[model samples]
Target: MTEPADIPSPERVLDAGALRALAHPLRVRMYDILSQFGPQTASSLAQLTGESSGATSYHLRALAKHDLIREVAGRGSARERWWERPRGSVSFTNPAVMKTPSGRAATQVIMSEFLNRRHQQLMRYVGDSIKTPEDLYDAAAVISSTTIRVTEEQARELAEQLTKVLSDASDRFRDQEGEGVVPFSLRVDLFPLPPESN
Candidate 1:
């Protein structure tokens, strides 16, 4: 799964087999940690997840076997290897695969966990708003949605444009170390508006 240096960040389209491998809770959480924090050793992730290093290492290997993540080269010795997310982002883009029995079950579990995590994050902000520093709190977040008309092609175009913009911004500023720079989270989803009927 090594990508060419000339390619911008690589996006993975996970099939049913890969999805099944990633359906575990710890694996999903480990993937998020690696993405947000950059490369990490299994020991480091284990410290974060309260699992033993051996357990986290096994999970990391499993994730690597499916190409959801990979070893970070030259960062660690054979005794302690480092791991990271593969390039840009990953998606479940194929509906034909997702419609299969195993694929549908895995998709449902992952999506439910994803939504649940988002809910927990929002709740943490509201619950801890009083304790959070005022400046950080003010700069924290916004969640909004809008419905619009769009055909399949138009929707695809919009998704492509949005991904390009986000990718550009991420690549430009990712390594610029400046004072007070902290990782920020962004999510954008584009899909057809469900039919309106009463």
Candidate 2:
């Protein structure tokens, strides 16, 4: 039997080193802020994160070391550096990283931090949904949950198909620069639930 060919993906998979570097709570928060708000200077991030400029600068350099974020070209100065999160999704589904206790712990930290941020975003959206502008709300607001039974392989297939759809749409509009353009997080969660206890 032949092995399946490795298919290219738009998402960047995080290795153990990158995962370890990003496992810190503050680093994760900074990365999320950069992603959500686009390029920012260390001073700006310091204000947003409520951390000192020195601290944010230190963490920013750490994130840059792993290529998770990069300094914006020709932006800011020696005292302040403009940093931005690179485009594309970051996947934390590295199997090898989960083989050891340390790797697993790091993975847990990153995942937990992201989940907390996402939950806060969801709650804020819900709170503002009623008062949000009709046009913007109608175009973007969606909160959905659906349950379906499927085999493991089938689940993987579904996820791949869904990912492709999102990737294509993202690529098409990724560079849109004009009025009404704004940063939006497109998130999808697909996983199996545990069996119910009697």
TM per candidate: 0.79, 0.86
TM-score winner: 2
lDDT of 2 by residue, 1-198 (tens): 111223223578899999999999999999999877778888898999899998999999999999999988887888777899877778876888899898899999999998999899888777677666574457755778999989999999999999888887666665567999987777788999988999
> Candidate 2 — which residues are off by over 4 angstroms?
1-10, 130-139
The number of the candidate with the highest lDDT is 2
Residue ranges of candidate 1 with Cα displaced over 4 Å: 1-7, 136-141, 145-158, 175-178, 190-198
Colliding pairs, model 1: none
Q: Which window of ten consecutive residues has the lowest lDDT sum in model 2? A: 1-10
Judge candidate 1 at residue 135 and give its lDDT: 44
**Cα-based RMSD of the predictions, in order?**
3.3, 5.8
lDDT of each: 0.79, 0.84
